[model samples]
Structure formats: structure tokens, C-alpha cells
Target: MTSVLALTAATAQADAFNRIASFPTHLNNAEANAESSAEIISATADGMTLVYSDSPLEVIGLIDITDPANPKAKGNIAVGGEPTAVSVIGNTAFVGVNTSESYTAPSGMIKAFDLATMTETAVCDLGGQPDSTAAAPDGSFIAVAIENERDEDLGDGRTGQLPGGFLVTVDVVDGSLDCDTVNVIDVTGIAEISPEDPEPEFVDINAAGEIVLTMQENNHMVVATKDGVINHFSAGQVDLENIDATDERGALVFTESQPNRLREPDAVQWIDDNHFAIANEGDMDGGSRGWTIFNKDGTEVYENGTGFEKAIIAAGHYPDKRSDSKGVEPEGMEFGIFNDTPMAFILAERSSIVGVYDLTDPSAPVLAQLLPSGVGPEGAVAIPGRNLFVTANEVDLIEDGGVRSHVMIYELTDAAASYPQLTSAGTDELIGWGAISGMSAGAGSTVYAVNDSFYGYQPTIFTIDTATTPATITDATVVTRGGHPAQKLDMEGVYFDGEGFWIASEGRTDRMIPHGLYHVDMDGNIDAEIPLPAELLAVERRFGFEGITRVGDTLWMAVQREWADDPENHVKLVAYNLETEQWGAVHYQKADPDTGWVGLSEIVAHGDYVYVIERDNQIGGAAVTKKIYRIAAADMVAAPLGDDLPVVSKEEVRDLIPDLTSLNGYVVDKIEGLAIMEDGTAWISTDNDGVDDSSGETYFWSPGKF
Candidate 1:
């Protein structure tokens, strides 16, 4: 029996740095603040910190963190501008101040503050402007991601070019407040990493004095010199299991043995100046556990084996638990593997568990620990000084009351030391009103969380916790999105380009019916909505879309078509052109009378190719060959829709893509959705919404001919 003394010992020690404290509170997992944007700047040993966007110059809030137990309110910084990125360097704080009432472009300001004096140090005027900023360790340089006035229109309503933004390095060598041209790294020239498109997110930089690493949201990392020179050798997709780049020359050395898919890379950290860890929120629809590890040279060091493999192994060992526990939906991750083993602190989105992995052995890592929390946990950061791992609980608020948003802190306990297990260690919930989505760390260890009301009934953007002086969460100012809910339901994923975000809303309601694609600006407003035609909208019981991908201005959606006639009818693929607003659909067809498609689950386009996940019709009472169809987009567009209506026969589709019987692995259940990784690999998900079978699982399909 577990004794009282043992239980007390298992309890986490109260550290003034790691404890959870409530300060500036608001709505959570709610619709009220739909379009609200919150981001975590940094986490410290004394207390955790954050920053949120409100409106005007009152858009900055400061919270006190002297006591981890109770985070007090320090005050507010009236920057009189809509702040975008919040970072702190020494006694000075930096914020991306926008002039527009909402988050538009015309003018912007780079406001500097003396955290000690709590006064503005300097302000620089710029256009298009800085989206995100990273301060140099010694306070020498501040690298800002800037774009030439957002130009061009991507059907979705956002105005950034194919590779819109550029990186501008500001020289802070002299304490001059005057604005002058420093250095700029033009991203417009960078080749599209993925054959499909490229959406790069500049992650963390190495603390090493010389070299800094910037990782993309889509999983590409580029090492740059302090002078803004790109180390092309160190740039590529994060595919390996483990990657460490600690050499003084800023050389990226990786594991050259085996390679794998590096899911959605949301965060990156330096292990010790060389070795680093990447947080991959594995693809849900694609059935990847998400997180993986890579060395500096772009080789995969550790991977959460394909989703199906993990499920198979888990079921083999803990069949009972496997039957109930939905596998990990990993997202933002920080390295802190339990029991002195190489581990990762994974943000499991769906299960809302902080999953710990023991990657002592890169190839086959074990599920170390899983700390439970509120719904839809996204980004996470490991603050070793505080012995606490924090996660952004970005839950979707579909119900009226709204699920509470959370900035959760979990104290790393020794319970796993004596008995290293994957379990919860209790969490301290902080202020969260709207769904807290994205998170990042800035100067001064200030943690910033983005509270995005993407799918809420109302849209607003707010900045919480302005300065690190005392570390208090202050709502900088409130920026509203015209005050109308884009009515986006089940908003699942969020990607920040510094300028704003391309948020993915997994619309799962009859109200919105099928689902739609939306764009929310940095200042909390629905810039525009790109939706499918009424035909694509899943009727009473029909097709529903879940996944989306945008390349340049081109957008692709993966929609699942339900059997409308006999429950055994095949599904169709709908492809829409963001430019001309043209729509084209391809229905599944099979030559064999018995091997017909019951449903068409997912659609993904890369280069000139397009792939679709097809659900199989019953074969001998069991699903056989749920295939992935690779068709040329041009050919798809050329396919006749028959008198302006989408209708295709099984035999016609069979003729379009030959050999349906010769695909890779097979799923015996309903294949629902699909998503493509940064590395061109495909991940598919299954739905058991109706079946009594526990066959609802995800699978990873490698890049190959089907």
C-alpha cells in the first residue's frame, strides 16, 4: 500500500518559480473572445510569465512572478498600439506595435521599454513591419521578421505573398534609439521547401553567441549568422529521430542512419548549445503520434514510430488501456524525458495530456509519462530552472458556456524517479478565458500564450502580461474582429507567420455543417473566409472536410464524403482553386464489381500530384484495400463533371488511376481524414463513429505509388 509519507514525498515541492498562480483572468475555451490572440514569451525560475494582445497602446499587461504560488499584477504598459510580438532583453522589453485599430497594415512601431523603469525607451516607425522578434543573448542584436507591406490577395483574404515576410536584423550594438537600416534576409527568394507550398515559422535560436537557428512551422530549420547570412548546409526538414548541433562553427550534425516524417514542428530548443530537441505535433488525420527528434544536420534521430505501429504495440501490451485510451495527439513539445533518459514533453492536443517520452534509444522510444489537463493542449516549453513544464491548453469552445482556456504548470516530481511512470503530477491552472492557442518565449523568460477566438461567436485579440518587471498578466488592449463570429467551428490547428496565423478550423457541427477555411489577422479579426460549395457540405449525413494545406496562395482541402445513398456508396474528392474560385471534384471508381469505394476520406496535393484516401467497400464482410489514389491535379481538373454536375462511375475512376489492388498497407475500417507532413509523407485517420469496432485508428503512408 502507498503510505502517507510516500504520498507526501510524491507531492511536488512548492518552488517560488514553478508554482501556478492566477493573475489577469478572462474567458476560456470560449466563443466570447473568438479571434483573441495570446502567446507565451518565456518561463523563469522565480515565476512563469506571459503576454496577450488587447487594443490601443494599453495593449500590454505586466504580471508579477516573485511568488510562484500567487502571480501578482505588476501594471500595464500603454504602448498605444496593437502589439504583435512581445520579447524582453535585460531591463528593456520589445513589442511589435501595430497602428491599425485591428491587425491591419499601414503603419507599425517597434516599442522599446525599460522593464526596470517601466517606461518607454524608444519607438521606431516601420511599415509592413515586424511580425516576430528574437533578442540576442548579450543584448547586442534584435532579429525581427518583417514583410514588405502585405501585398497580393490569397483567396482566403490574407495579403502576404507566397513567401511574404523577410528577416530584418536590428543592430543594438549602440544604445541609440534612432531608426536606421540594419540588415535584411529576403525570404521571397527561398525555394518552396515542400513541393506543395511553404509556411515557415521562425522557432528559437541557439543561445550560442555566433549561430542562431530558425525552424519553420512546417518543420524546416535554417541556421543563420548574426549578420543574417544563411547557412544553407544547416537548412532542411527535421526528419531524423534525434539531432544535436553543438559545434562552435554552427555546423548542423545529424543522425545519418534512418529517416522518418517530422510531423508539425511547433517548437525547438538547444540541449546544450549543440544537441537540440524538436516538438512535432504529430498529424492527427494522418495517424502520426506527431513529435520526433532530429540532429542539427537534418537527420531524424527519434520518431514516435508510425501511428499504427504505436497503437499495435500499445494494444499488444496494455490491451485494456489501449481499448480506452486514445493514442497521443502530440503537439508543442519540450525535451525533459523522465528518469534521466532522453525524453520529450509532448502536448497531446486531443487527449490534453503532457506526454513524456523516454528516447534514450532514438529509434524506439517508450511512452514515459502523460500528465492530464484541460482540452486541446498546443504549445509547451520546458523551464529547467523552474523544474516546471508548462502547456497552452487551447481548447475549442463550441458549447455555449465555452471550455476554459489554461496556461497549465506541472511540477516535475521524483515519483518517476523511484517509479518512473507516465502519469499526472497534478497541474496549477492560470487565467484563461478564450482558447489559448500558440505560445513562444521571448527575452527575460517571459511566457506568452495566444488566446485565439478563431471559431467563437465573437472575435477579439488581447495581449496579457506586458513586462517582466514583476511578471503580472495585463490585457494590453482588446482588438475586436468586427464583432462577428466567423462561425468557424472546431478550430483545431494554428500557425503563426509573425504577421498573423493561418488557423485550421475542424468544423464538426451541423450549424456550420461540413466546415470551412478561415484567416484571422494578428489583431484578432477574421480577414476572410474560403469555403467549399454547398455540394461539398456534408448534408444530414454526408461529406465533411477536416484538413487543409496552403502552398503559396494555392489552397487544398481534404474532405470526407459519407455514403448518402446506400451507406456503401463511394466518396468524392473536391479540389477548389483559391485564385479563380473554381471547384472540381473526383469520385472514386473501381473496375471490379466487388472492390468499390465506400467513402473518399482525404485529399492532398503536392507539386503536380494529388492524393486521395479512399475508404473501402466491404470485402468478404471485412474492409480490404482502403487505397490512396495519386492523380495529377491537371488531369483531375480535366476530368469531365458531366453537364456541370459532379458524377463519376466506379469504372471511370478505376481507369483514371490503375492498379487499385497494389497499394501499401491496408486499413480494415473507415478511413476518415488525411494530412501531408513537411516531408511529403501522408498520415491518415479513421472514424468509428458508427461501428462498434475499435478499428478507429490512424495510419502513416510513405511517399510512394499506390
Candidate 2:
């Protein structure tokens, strides 16, 4: 078994990064309905202001980090086209604007804005579509990666689609760009894979006036000096073993292997003048699922193999759905020296995690911490002068009513890491778990929880030990049928039945998964399946059973939303008798949502009441109701279905908004699991939607006596 002693003691460290604030990108836009994003962020010389490229809004957003704990929006400036990247030198912000007409006819420019006046000061025609921009440390010149990125749909998505890309270097004096001195460096015949198409994805300049660039699709790297002389090398390849290589399989199996995988790096940053690090975010055929450190002479110093992805898996942040592709997709990276210690921050695009590593010994870097970001962290900026680090998350989920793109800020201090409130870290085998849907108290301080349909092919029951500071998942049991993992189950609720457990599967008729109750032994072996009766099935909707609780010989199930036969704002509390095998129901009134629909998420029977978690479908600031209400156990008399059921009265037990926002993140929509112990200690958790377009932040906390 993996040793828990070290993992538990590691939490006592006093030096770590802690998130302080999050600023939504939409706040910079004048229209609330329009979608916005924060990508490719850069900080000013004073390290008090932040500027990010917003491609969807075609603008560059500015934020005042004068007070890093509570960032304020400073509005946006139109870049006239899609803003791809931004870099701030002194008080001026240089943005790369993409105005591509087609893959064959790519066009872009570099627009410099005076942040003090919020006005465009200079515009230099880049002569091709640009992907990334970087300013020299000495402010002598600025480098732009003219990507002329390939059209994935054309020519089988290869890089050799012609009209290849190059690099541009422009002189800068007194914080102003001299457009007349723009120099376009031709970078062709560089790599054997795509010798004709050089798609430079990212650029970074060191203190020695040398520029390092990554041609992502071509799988090559180029180091250009001040005189425009270039030294190019192939990014090379890696052999991957013990990884999950199948996509959409609904399970995480790491027995697969892929040999000779290309390290098609995306983002590169110089740790010093002689060495640099590259995030191997492969495009088509590779993604080593790690970062690499290399010398200026093309000698590989260190290759992280599957170590980074494995760490993410231990933190329950692995994107199992993207297993077949670039797992975790480490895309952006930043290097800085904080407290005299060199550090490297690696951003995982798919996992939404930022790995902070201490480069005290360049050859042997140590992972310090893993901080959670918004949905997709596209870029990061580290300001050691202020002991601050920032990430620009580029995903805007407005269409799904989810949290918008955010710019998360973290402060480096002598404090313990406040994140990763829950983990399966010390387990003997890696336990990849998320989307915690239902929970029930087991024997003593133990609790049993089940994952939703996100792991449909590997439905599991996790055993948690809640005595630790951050609860630990001690073991996992796969809910199996005929010795095989049960399939087509969207388990939403689970209840302890004195021996084993009774699970409620929320059905989706469209997906061929039916609504039912399952009886499983302690080992998670499905002994029986009980389908919903015809009387309830006739009125059932996709939002069926959400929670289950047992009292005496009756099983109580909370229906998620209103059904066809139920009154408006009223859902049924279904009851099933174990002795008589009869079904009954009771009406439970819920508050009407102001924007989205309100529904019941969890149900748990306590000493004198049945506690239910009532929530709305809306997330973030739009959420109206996230509460727990209790119904008197004496009022749980069930009436036969197909008749007017007695409406149960409820008393507000707690408003979960405070607990949801306790970590400073926006309110999540899914508060789907609750487990109350015999001592009245209640534990609650939120569903992360299996980290699919979600922040992948599962909040598990105890509200004390309920």
C-alpha cells in the first residue's frame, strides 16, 4: 500500500501558494450577454496591473491588481481583430492580432497600447498570423511568433498546408515599438516532419537577447540570436508507458503504451540563459503528457515522462475523457524566482491544474504544490517582485450557464496550501474519482460515495475516511454485475441499508439507461435491480431520482425535478416498501427559481427529520437557491401514487451559499451529495460534472451539527 504517513505529514508545510482572488473576464465587457475570455496574460513592470488577450471579444482586457486579493476590472480595448497574445513592457501592452482570411492567406499585426491612457500607440504589420508575442527582458526588441497556423480540416490536418510561418523581431525604445525596424526571419526547412510548414506556436526571450520558439505542429524548436542567426533542432520523441490511451471509454485504465510519441511542445520558457523548459502539448500524433528541460545546445536535461500526469491523477484532476488524446495537455508555462528560489509553474489545459515546482536543483525539480484554476488555463504570468502568480483561463461557458472565463490570482506566502481539500493521494493504487453524486454514512466516521455516469463503464463506490484534515479516500469498490462493471448507470443517490447499500440510478431514456433502485453488497456486487413502477414511469422525466435514504423498512427517494403528473414547483418524494414491495409518494414543495430551474439534489434521513439539499441549475452569481431543508419524520406518511399526495412542510436548516463560497470561488451548481453521521455531523459534496467543461473543483465539507 502507498504510505499515508508522508502524504499526511506533507500538509503541514508552511511555504506554499494559495489562491486569493478570481476575476471573471465577462466583467470587462459592456454587454453582459456577450461571451468573453482571458487568454495569454502579462503583467506590467510594477506588477500591479494585468492585461490579457480576449479573442472572442476581439479585445485586450485590463485588470488592476493593485490589491491582489480583490482584483478590479479596468475595462477593455478593442484590438480590431482576434487578440491572440499579450505582453506588457513598462506601461505599454503589446498584443498580437490575428486577421487571417484563410489558411493560404494569413494576416496579422502587432498593436501596442499605452496602458496609462488605454489607447493604441503603435501598430506594426506582422505580415502573417501571429500566435504568441514576447518582449525582451532588456526591452531592446520584441519577438512575435508568426504561426500562420494550419487549417486542421484541410489536407488531413497536417502542418504542410503551405503559406508557412516565420518569426518577427521589432526594435523597441523608451517602451515604444519602432515599426520601421521590423524584421521578419524566414524559418523553413527546419524539421523533417513538416519541412515546408514552420508553424511557430510560442516565443520566449531570455536576458541574453536570445529568442526561443516552438513550432508545435512541426515538432521543432528554434533559438534565434539578436543578429537573426538561428539554431534549430527537432523536439524529438518519447516512449510512453503505463498511461490511459483510450478516449470516451468512460474509464481510466493505465496499462496502455504508446512508443515514439512526439514531444510537440507548445509553450517554452527560459529558466536561465543556458536552459529552458517546454510544455509538450502535442497537436496531432503526440503529447508526451509532461514537460521537458533542455540545454541551449539541444541536450535534454530532464524528461518528466508520465510523472506529471500521475500527480494529477493522484489529485483527482485527471481528464479521463481526453485519455486517448493529450492527457492533461500541459500547454502553458512560466518561470520565476521567489524568495531566492527558482520556480516553474506548469499549466495543464485539460486538467485545470497548475503545478508549482521548485527548481532549486535544475536537474532534479521538486513538485511543491498543485493549485486549481478556472476551466482551462491558457496562460500564466509570475511576478516574483510581488510574490504573486496569475493564470488566464480561456473558457467561457455562457452557453451552458456555467462559470465564465476567469483570471485567478495566487499569492506566495509562508502559509500551508489551502487547496486540494479532498484527495485519494496515499492509496495503494491511483484512485481517479470525481463527479461525486450520492453519499451515505457508513460505519462510524466512514462514508460511502458513488460517482455519476461520467464513469459509466466503471461505476464505483468509494470508501472515505473523514477523520483526516482533508478527508482521504481509503478504498474503492467497483459496483459490478456478473463479476463485470455494471454499465448504463447514472447513479445519483446512495443509502446505507445496515448491511450493504441501496443506490438510485437517475435514468436517461434517450441514452437507454433506465431509472431504478439497485441493491449491492458491501463488496459492491449488485444483487438485485428494482425498476420504477409503471405508475411513476409514465410521469418520469430525465431528471429522475436524485437521492435515496432508508428508514425502517421504507426507502425514500428524492425526484430531481418536477414530473408530468406533479404540480408546478412540487416534486415527488418516492417511497418503496421492502416488506410489501409496494410503491408510494409524497409531494415536496421547492422554491421557484428566478432564472433557471430548481430541483432536489440529495436526501438523508436523520434522527427526527429527513434533510434534503435543494438547489438551482444556475451557477456562479446567478444562483438563487442553494439550501438544505428538513421535513419532520412524522410527516413522511406516503400516499399511493396516481392520487393527490399530502404536501410535506419543510424548515430551512442551512443556506449553503456561505459554505460554497468559503473557498472564494463562485458558487457551483451541483450540491448533490450529503451524508449525516449518528452524532449529527453532516458532510456535503458537490458534483464536478466529471470535470467536463466544469472547473473540476469538488467541495467536500462538514457543516457541523445539522
Candidate 3:
């Protein structure tokens, strides 16, 4: 059964999660230059404030969500140690601090703070490293998972090290912790694997005062009643079929199988007194790549095998680079009753998506929605009273000039779902597409786009139908050479010729991929290959052709950046005559960068002029130039190679900053595709870097009939 949450605008009008606001973690950091992250979030009883643990900064950051549409940063509080988890009861926040010196001597504490005064109230020594914390639903006590946490490099990265983990329960009276009432419960010899090293990963309590814990490395589950009586069971394993089990292969193939794969669960949440759910984020031996529901007595109720993964692939959010490690990596989970319906929110850490399931019937839950999160969603909190949902994304890519760690807010409303602007849901077969570099208009409303070097082993041209809202990919044709999947090709651009497509393969000479052009038939069979002339090859750089377009008998290629022989702030618009068999060039002056370098990304020819996408390499707020400029055909006079190329004048057609941020996200760096239809309607798209270290959000829309 394909568990696809096929949500469209018309069908999602009842109640859906729609993103309303995003707050970057850096806004609360005092250093401004230091990296910070938002992880393990908890909300106040009023549901107006959010607090998250920031281990990198050794602090706990706060955000005011009174107005869910405009989240305000409340700054950070120094915790003096690594804060592992946080939970709130009334006006006080309970934080678990890890101060472990070594695996053999793990030590930590539980720090309680008063929200009104913003001061520490009390602390209880846990005597072990704490990983997760949860407050009793009735506010009577708090539970902490004391994970001694074995070192992966020691003993082959398995468990069974010294000082096994345990659980700590503390009495809470009027939002204040009673340090003397702390009770430690030993959870040893519970699982079949590494029974001596029960590394407790997560904890949650139900309304009946029963605490459930997950021993991730041990592949075990434990349930402790309020009176300290415990029952334990093994998480067990499952048979996985139709999965991509290899890593970094530059392709997505789901034909492999892994039988008896262990479900080393990470985050567990009690849905009711008798049932709960676990995110199977395996640690030592296995990760099943999906979630499972279990009865309180360890009876397997429902296991969503590869169905959840298939849905993520259909939505174009699969993480191909993590195929071998843990596909999608479902790491966090939260359960709540919203609008009288029990809902489960499962967080896929690598894919940066939140899967919302309606648990009206726990035996067979319905996949309702898939919410787009930040780069890595590690924790989630549901504010059902306010009809709101919050997620803490833990990835901060500041060093790579990418978006910082963010906390995203979503509201449950009757409005239609706004995310997933592009999907492969209605296609004949499952299609995965990302890193869209260049595009060309085909017959009618169809457009053809090519993936870049990210999928070097499976170069494919995708056919997108723009007539549908949130355009859908209808077909994908694998680009072939000698009747086999092409290799060593970094296809950046595609142009629909009279018979087939003229493709521009951006080359890296260091990797032996020469800068060249290839003509492929409609069936994706290469018919001809043309190498750069001697004059251009001598001056070529790794940043070669980015886009290609055909104008009558000539083909124009937009050089991405300045070559060895080009002037500063200018790149060549090289032209090759199909009939004359000659090569020439013209320089197109680009904008100077405010921080990083700027260059051209795409080129297209219309009636009387040609349009090109010019952008800066900087992302988010640091970006300066992301626009479309046009050069009149009369000024595109190609000069012979080895001679001074005449520079062409440009006219600004559109400023794309608004379009890039229209979806309420930080601006992406790669605006690499442009397609104009026969009716003069213009369309543009941004490359998602194949969801590798990316938010996996692709924007494909028009700038109002340019």
C-alpha cells in the first residue's frame, strides 16, 4: 500500500498545517558571529512563549509566539553547561544539563527556572549524563532519561561500556523541584543487544502517570509507573524492502532490501493510556527509515514500513546522500489532540519535513499532510489550544553561507495547504527531481528541466506541466550514452531544438569532464558531441557554461563566471553557428558582489531579445543581486575568438528578490532556470542542491507574464 498524503488545495480545506513564521537562531545570540542551533523546544502553559536548548552556545534561547504570524526573539540564557533537553510546567522551565567528564564518570543535573523572574530556582544532581526530559501531564513530577552514552570510536561504536544509563524521576510541587525527592530507576539487562549498556534516549509520560523510555542503542523500550514499577521489552526488527541502501552514489535506486532490520527507536510519545508511537531512528545496528506504533505491552500495532519514505520521495524531499546511513532519518515525534482529533507529528531530520497523521483510528492512521521545515527538524511542540504547531530545526550552515538554524511556526486552519509547490504525486511512476539548473519551454504548457552534477550517475531530463497549481512532473527520461546511463556529465542547461535538445555540460577539468555541448534525441540518446575550440579551451575555468539557448541557426551559451581571459565583472556569451560551423563570443557585464562573487545562471531567447538570470552566490540576508536582464538581439553581435569581444548593454526586466522570498523563507542562492512559453508567459525556478545540506524547498513560479 502506497501511503501517499496526496493533499491538494481543494482537498485540504478542512484543517491543515500551514507555515506562518520562521525565526533564525542567530537572532538570539549575543556573539552575532558564533554558530547557534534550536533544538529540544518546549512551550509555556499559555502557549505564547517557546524555549529551546542550544548546546553549541551553552544557552537556552527563547522566542515569543504570542502572535504566531510574527515570532519575536526573546534572547538566550546562559545555562553554564550543555543543555540536553527542556520542558515546562506552569511558569517554571525544567532543563537537563550534561556535564559529563567521560563515559565511565557521567554526571549532570536538572535546572529549574522561573519564567517570570528569568532566574534559576533549583537544581538536582542527576549523577549521569541526561539526554531527554519530560514533565508529567498532571504537573506532579518530571522524568529524565540519563543516557551515559557510549563513545562510538570505543569498542566498534557499540554499547556495553561502563556506567549504564538509568531514569530519574523528581517530584514537582507548585512549579518548583524537590531535589531530595529524586528517585533513580535502573534499566539494565533489558534487551538482547548490549544489555549492559542501556542508553536511554527519550522519555515521555502519559495521563495515567506512566513514563515510557527508549533505549536507542540497546534497541529496547521501558515503561515505569508512578510508583517505580518497570516493564521492559525489545524494540525488535523488521524486514525492509524497496529501499536505496547505498550512500553518495549520485543516484536514487529503491530496488534493494534489508531483512530483519532493527528498529532502534529514538523519540517515543504516548498517544493515550494504552498506546504510543516511536520514531525508528536506529543508532548502532539499524534504522528502519520509518515510524511504528506499539501497544503499552510491546505489541506491534502498526508499522509504516517504506510507505512514509515513498511519500517523501513523491514530494521531492528525499535525501540521496544519506541513503546508506539512514534514509530520511525520522528522529523526533510529538502527539497531541487538536480539534478533538488525535494527531501525530513525525519529524524527518535529514529531509526537514514534518509528517502529520490523523490518529482517529490508531490501528490505521491516515497520512494527512507533510509540512516543509527548516534544514533539520530535531524537535516539535504542538500548541493545540492555539491551533498552532512549532518545530526546532537544528542545522546551522553559516560556515557554508547557507540559512541558519530556524524555528518554524505553523497554524491549523481551514485554508488550503501552501507548501510542496512542486511534486511528482500524479505521475505514472515515482519520480525524484532536484538541483534543477536550467529549463526550456516545450510544446504548449510543458517545460523540460535538467538536474546538475548531483545525480551524475543518472542524468535525467524531467517534463513539468505548468498548467497545474504547484506544478507536477509528468515524466523523466534518463539521458543516455551508448544505451547506458551517462557518466561524467554535469548537465547545467537544456534547450529544446527542432528535433531534440541541445545540452550544456559544465565541466571540471580536474575531474576530466571537458567543457562541451551534446545533442540528444527525444529518447535521450546522444547523437553528437562538440568540444570547445582551442581559443576558448585555453582560457576555460571550472565555472563553464551554465545555460544554452537557440536563436535561428546559432546556439548561445551563457558562461557562469569570468574565464581566465575575460575582463573583470564580465563573462562570455559564446555563440556557435550550426550551419556555418564557426565559434564566436560577446561579453555580458555582470554586477559586482556585495560579499561573494556574482554570475549568470540561465539564458533564454524570446522575440526581439534574450533574457538571462543574474545572481550572487550569497544566501539569505547577505544576497544582493538576483534579477533578470535582457539584451536586444540587435546588440548580440558575436566577435571572432582571440579578438576583443564587444560588451552588450542590458535592460532590467525583473527584480526576483520578492519572488524568491514569497514563500516566507530565506532567499536561496541558486536561481538557475528560466523558461518562456509561446504566449510570452515567463517562468523561473531555483535549484535546491539535490536536498544535500539544503532545506529541500524548490520555488517554481512566474513573475507575472514578463
Task: Write the number of the candidate with greater TM-score, choosing between 1 and 3.
Answer: 3
- After superposition on all CA atoms, how large is the RMSD of candidate 2? 3.1
Instruction: Quote the positional error of residue 445 for candidate 1 in Å.
Output: 46
Model 2 clashing residue pairs (backbone):
none
| Segments of candidate 3 deviating more than 4 angstroms | 1-14
lDDT of 3 by residue, 562-659 (tens): 99999899999999999998999999999988888999999999999999999999887788899999999888889999999999999999888876
Cα-based TM-score, every candidate: 0.45, 0.97, 0.97
lDDT of 1: 0.42
Candidate 2 on 265-304: residue-level lDDT in tens?
9999999998999999999778999999999889999889
Clashes of each: 89, 0, 0
Better of 1 and 2 by lDDT: 2
Q: Write the per-residue lDDT of candidate 1 for residues 496-599, one digit (tens) a residue.
A: 33465544444555545336666667666768767755544434243454344444444554445443431234444445566767665555453233544344
Clashing pairs in 3: none
The local lDDT score (0 to 100) that residue 163 gets in candidate 2 is 87
